[model samples]
Target: MSAADGSASAADGSVNALTSALWERRPQTSVRIVDAHAHVGPYSLFFIPDAGSDGMVRVMDRCGVSHAVISSHLAIQLDAAAGNAATAEVVGRAPDRFTGYLTVNPWQDPARELGMWGSDHRFGGIKLHPDLHDYPLTGGRYAPVWEFAQRTGCPVLTHTYDGSPYNDLPMVDEVAARYPDVAILAGHAGATPNGFDAAIEVARRRPGVVLEVCGSFNSGSDIARMVREVGADRVVYGSDFPFIDLRMSLGRVIFSGLTEEDRAAVLGGTMTRLLQWRSGRE
Candidate 1:
């Protein structure tokens, strides 16, 4: 794919030129195409052996993704502080291209971890995985995270899936209602196209709730619907990289049939503003 035309010349996963041009033109509109959700390290669950920050950067360069907000497997799967430190180290190496979301488990000294990680400029937000942590979103133990977000005006991206007893949108909505000042990003927005509407409804009911679209499979039409129902500002793009292909994830946004301005907001503008809630940290 060359910039002269937007055609995919081959299926080698290379970005076509027209696609490149579209992303390249984003800065003129004062928005960067930022991936709001992503992860690094060896994921033991899915058996992904290894994918680090360097590999992530290579994919971003090819796909015209200006930056990515990332968490680490250590944080999500193993230990929060270790994963956060690993992520911070990676971001420290390429501060211009990467930012971090420090992962924290509710049961693990939540307040101390939140304070320790949140104070670092390299980390712009927080990431939570209730499924991995085996906790409910509204559980009392998780109160510190919500309180921290509310007080600091930081964004929290939590793993959410609709139709599940755990990690569903309704649970996220309950937390959002309690902390109106905190911005909550619903991870994957339901985990598939079918869950989009439920996630959209959550965002509709709570203005502070935002949808992070980053599942293994999502449809372009679903993305358009999200923009329409929740408005583009409430929807953000995230490629669950290494776990999923980044190029394919970028394609969803490019072909979602969104207006340029709305696309810009979904791609990066909204996240930029959300991260900025911490006094322009990212």
Candidate 2:
């Protein structure tokens, strides 16, 4: 079938159309998709057979992901500078298919790290893994990142979960209030059943904060509930690719029983808006 015909079918709000497209590995051209959260490089903790950029882009093609924002596993776990460099390389190679998040290690000299790559157009935002780094989200060390984000009008994507001393929804809410200019993507949206409500409440209160849907715990129904609670504009889709299966994550959003408009926004519209400022800098 022609691309136009496919677009018509996908836009008809037929779940069967979407299901067939997914199962057949056909690109759904009708939907503009940008994966808000993703990763590259191998992780010591997990075995990822295809963790490099080439593998990532191949899957993105097969699944119809037009673009993906990535941070190298190295940046999040071992060496921030090296990891950021690796992420930059991937984005540089495929400027259209990818953009990168500059991973900042608060334990290290954050200011120095930001200074090195903050101006690079390949990097669209900053990524913080407070859970992995074991730093409290509200700690003073992350000040540089907030300040940089505010100045550049770039969004900050941070790892968040339930009941951790660091980077929970409440803690993210506190940071959002203090750095109101910085758009915050609450990664994982407080992963797990218990944290979902907390994530919704925080997004409801913080205009600058948006809930990113990803994680093993969230089901299609859970995604539908989040949209009902916070509104579709407040949620964005993320696939922790290389860590989790991207196809499964994308499938959840596609089949979540959301209306066509809501599903479109969650899949890409919201994230596209969130990244506009950074893209404008290019």
Candidate 3:
């Protein structure tokens, strides 16, 4: 049986079970990985219990991943408050190695509750899984969450793509258009069944909106296309870790044929600046 956090699995049921082409490449990205889209440990990689918090830190160290942002899948499935609190606790053990993203309920008293969560130091920003949360990003009820983030100078990370508009893109784009400074991160980088075009469009149209390197990968040509269409600064590295391998995912970025500067930005520099901004808030 697989434990949620990716601990002690049998050779048959490894983390690589559902991995992709990059997983097969086992490409050596070599650069220090900054997993922007990973879920923290202790919540199992897939939201099962007993994933163990230490698993995150240990695996990160093993893979040369310098840092990661942990979001609670629990909040996505169950209690938002508990999810946020649990995610915070995981990051607390190794603050230097992990960044916490507070998972909030899009359907909850988003305005009042989100405003109230501003002081949680563990949270660098907000994470929204519109598809999983069952809320519309463009819906008026969600505006308060974006507005508050803009006011507080924090970014919001949301799942966005070609499909799942109600859960992902249109609303993300709408909210992003509303608050340019909020730094909305378009999760998945539109990386799935042919979403690159839309991901590219968002990068072109939205100045502060960036594509996160998560449950997504690009063909060599696709990677080149991404850079040509959106420019490299709009790109950021992320690993949907525990769910994927740091080495493999980082390899996708490192090998994606972008300029050295662009590679630096995507590898970790761009996010490094974002983290510095977050530090001032603390």
Candidate 4:
């Protein structure tokens, strides 16, 4: 079905159809599935045997995820230039299946980094990891990145945690307040049970802010609650990919107590709209 078509109803046994497809390791064609937050390449701290683009595509195909927006581990943690280059190569290889987030390090020349790929179609958005970079979301260093996003109307996905001095909900809210044109994707949605409420409140307060449901700490019930509280349109699905298994993360949404329409919105509809917004500006 098309992303705009929300005809899949619970009474029509759509949930059962999705569950069966998921169990069989087949694509669920009933709705378009998109992974809003994912990472590529190996990490310094962990072992991911299949962390390459090919492996990521294999898993995405298995889970019926049509598209993924990813940033490389090297870009967020180690080197933004090399990591972003790797991400561009992945997108170039499979443009239909993948789009990248231009990772910007606040400590580095963010404006120059953004200028290099700001207009590159391979990148759909910008990614920030304040915690790993040891920078606050509201820091002056990120000003250029925020300005670029605001000017281009690009989506910015930033890692957020509950009460994290770097990227907590309050910090995100402050940035979102200033850059109203940029669609701020609150990555991980605070990342814990205790943080979900705060994430919800921030999303409620900021129309440009959207909640990304991922992270190993969240439950399906938490996703349902977020949907109930903020409405399905404000929540998007993310799997952190090789960092966490895609299968289990997807299962949480499929098996959750959400209607087929809500599930569709979270899985792809919202992200599709966000990406389209980016494309339109370009």
Candidate 5:
């Protein structure tokens, strides 16, 4: 597929020739896009050729992804202080290219920075991996963290799936309902595309919870149903990258069975609105 072309008028001048070239490599189905979920793991951790900062931008440029939210899996080993600092350091350089979620390991650190960092605007919210880091969201250790998030007005991202031991999906429900003010994004659509009905139901019942769609779109209707239940705005897009092909996943939605308006929201508008809520428009 050749890149899609848009002619620039004499007044504005043409866009980079490479921009159109990149678009053609994208799936037959294309949409102007912003990726809401993506991770920037260290080289040794995820073992991408050079998954460091610049590699991220390069992939974005090729895939026609305008922006991404980056997190690190190193949080599994490093304490939240170091993991979050690393995340912020990467985001700091490419403010235009990246937004980040502050990762927390409650076993090692309480993640006080989840909210406090908002003063500096370094992180968009807090990220937690229950099975990977072995912290139980339903346990008492997480109460204060949820309280702090409520006080500071940041969200929490939680990992869920059938293989994982921690059953935090129910716990996520409890917290989001208890702390109605604090927002929570169910990372990876509860980790099972087909198993997502319950999670979407939770988001439907609770306004603060959002279902983050990533790596789950094996079928086009998966995205269409997400929009139907969550109403587009409450749903967001992500690639979980260096793990999934950002371009392929975005193309899945762009070519999805959804209506054009709904597809547009999944591609970028909903995510753009979420960022706008945090930093006041991009």
Candidate 6:
């Protein structure tokens, strides 16, 4: 067919009606998309206001994101107890759409708080920001938390990067080795360009260390490379929304050169499996 015949043309001046129809009818709806990392409360360090649950729900709907695993900025940047409480309340507001990750400081008795809130239906996992909280992942103080996670099959999402002062890849690797049963998410996959390879290396060596793609600048090719190296089962999609645009983070995976099954796993399936495993659904 030709443009002259009321059909679009390629550079070769050829076209197929069936190809056009199929392209027009391509699937518009998506499978369940989950943002595995997000913040709900204000960050005192950054001086930014909170992006409440309502704000996040609107963003999720706009991007066709079915669920988000969220933690509290207040917990990471300031008070762990209050932040966990706030996260629980927000997650409780929309149990179907949101899952809370109880943020805690290693120095504190995380187990005490974990005992109180760990079984709450609104909570799915734990979040630890060693860099922000200024605790080394290898420190003995964190051992109790690790033990608890391993025993309960709780996934821990930890802040990770190349040169962060506290818990970079090296420390994370050690922790992963120590707690083999605890599901660990490297929250940024080493959030910077230099950190990407390091994150991949750690994930490759440590079966428990799953890569979380959540930064604003993570490239599509980088995500695709992670899938190639570690398999889609070990990579989960996360937006780090409000801090970074949820759309931007989601776009990285959507446009990555991954097969349909791999892309689906990264976007939601991997996390879904992690959640189910944590909650004994697996």
Task: Name the better of 3 and 4 by TM-score.
Answer: 4
| TM-scores vs. true structure, each candidate | 0.87, 0.93, 0.81, 0.94, 0.81, 0.87
Model 4 Cα shift for residue 116 (angstroms): 0.3
lDDT of 2 by residue, 201-280 (tens): 88888888888988999999999999999889889999999789788899899988898889989999999888888656
Give the whole-model CA lDDT for all candidates, comma-separated: 0.82, 0.90, 0.68, 0.90, 0.68, 0.81
Error of 2 at 177 (Å): 1.3
lDDT of 1 by residue, 1-282 (tens): 475454333321233333655566431223378989988888876676459788878767766788888898888987887888899998999988888998888767777787787789888889999988888888888888888788788899999987666688889888988888889999999886667778888899999999888887688888899999989999999988877877777779877877767877998899988888767443
Say which candidate scores most in TM-score. Answer: 4
Would you list the rank order by TM-score, best first? 4, 2, 1, 6, 5, 3
Residue-level lDDT of model 5, residues 3-111, one tens digit each, is 3332223212222222344455642224557677777766344457656778878878766777787776565456667767778888898888888887767686464
How many clashes in each structure?
3, 0, 5, 0, 1, 0
Question: What pairs collide in candidate 3?
Answer: 4-44, 4-45, 5-44, 5-51, 138-171
lDDT for each residue of candidate 6 in 1-282, tens digit (9 for 90 to 100): 566655323321222221232246442244678889988866665654447788878767766788999988887787888888899898888999999998878766787778778778788888989888788878887776788788888889999978888878888899988887788999999988878899899889999999998885579999999999999999999988777778778767776757667887998999998888545533
Model 1 lowest lDDT segment of ten:
8-17
Task: Please write out the lDDT profile of model 4 over residues 81-144, one tens digit for every residue.
Answer: 9999999999999999999999999987898889899889999989999999999999999999
Check candidate 1 and list the clashing pairs: 1-17, 2-17, 3-17
What is residue 239's positional error in candidate 6, in angstroms?
1.1
Instruction: Give lDDT tens digits, candidate 3, residues 87-185.
Output: 888888788888888777777666655766667777777888777767777877777777777777777778775678465555666777778787888
Candidate that beats the other on TM-score, 1 or 3, i.e. the better one = 1
Looking at model 4, the pairs that clash are none
* Model 4 weakest lDDT span, ten residues long: 3-12
| RMSD of candidate 4 to true structure, Å | 3.7
After superposition, the stretches of candidate 2 with alpha carbons farther than 4 Å from their true spots are: 1-17
